[model samples]
Target: MSLTSNIADGRKKKRRRMKSDSDISRPSPMQSHIDACVSFKDKQVAARVTSDAKMDEWFVVKVINFDEKTKKFEVLDEEAGDDEEGGVQKTYKLSASCIIPFPERNDPSGTQEFPAGRNVLAVYPETTALYKATVISTPRKRKSDSHVCKLTSNLLCAYLRGYLLEFDDDEEDGALPQRTVPFHKVVPLPEWHRQRDLCIKMRLNSEFGVLNM
Candidate 1:
């Protein structure tokens, strides 16, 4: 499948038009936390980037605590923004399921799937260099020590391509390729918020449709 399907120019890809689910897979990181994450999906909103430039690194953010007053999840932003009266604020309101969790693959194999647990979510904007997102939940280790970290759509693609590229290089030179390792980490969102945009960009890709892996 081509990576340029729904991408419009260098800045936009409409999710409504995304018609493929081929890229969706159950990577190892989400094996333990999937159920916990599904429980919070309806209460979150995710932000992602459309440009390839922003997808190079990982975005780690903290999930906003559930609110009882407005009955919506609130996200914190390190970037300053102006209010209607021009006051600076660092928080925003997100719609339900706007953010969801995905598992990050470390040493990803085309033949394995992990059990579900907790995950984080983010949103992808139309014209940004990277997807913007907020962390939705803190990871808690289960009895089996199943811990998972979600990845942005761009990151997932990058990880696969990068590994493949390296493998190809080794193969062409008549050398055995090294095993591929997953490029993901499990960290606290609040601690990593200012470090990375802390988000993911994803759309359904028909070529990588949801495989129960």
Candidate 2:
């Protein structure tokens, strides 16, 4: 065999070895934590964008697709309207580290649905801790009710009519005050609250603690 032919054969063998090593080092799809939680066509969920400088900002998005091999997702941002001329919608391809699912209550069918008057825990903007609140109202597409004169001159009420939230914490005299907050800022309570409320309800039931007589 010629010397050039032998050199070419050696180079081909090295390339094959490198390819085999890469395949072995690659992580399996099942091993990815992001793939386990993500599902295509899942209900829209609130996710905080961590990849940007504004990490605290949250947006509602639906999972369009999941790349199990890459452990990434293609999400459709419902809040971000399509471009003019009805172009492509606002979508993002982000890794799990760049997104976090918000705490939300899901129905048995895996749909996130919250109705008005539902009790929830919400964090107001610039607040560090969650506060007990009730969903008084959600934003409507049409203005059904006529605007009333403000009892007090508050600039917030003048411009935007946000989500109406009634705080569970009341005054010493038992007066609960309601405040308007942006919808994205509000989220469902943690799991601990749900379990605690369940226990309290069971304890109050008549047959809960009755001894067998």
Best by lDDT: 2
Q: What's model 2's overall lDDT?
A: 0.58
Superposition error at 122 for model 2 (Å): 0.8
**Over 4 Å off in model 2, which ranges?**
1-113, 141-160, 204-213
Candidate 2 residue pairs in backbone clash: none
Candidate 1 wrong stretches, greater than 4 Å:
1-45, 48-61, 68-71, 82-89, 102-213
* Tens digit per residue, CA lDDT, model 2, 103-127: 3232112324346887765555454
TM-score of each: 0.25, 0.38
The stretch of ten residues in a row with the least summed lDDT in candidate 2 is 103-112
Q: How badly does each model clash, as a count of residue pairs? A: 47, 0
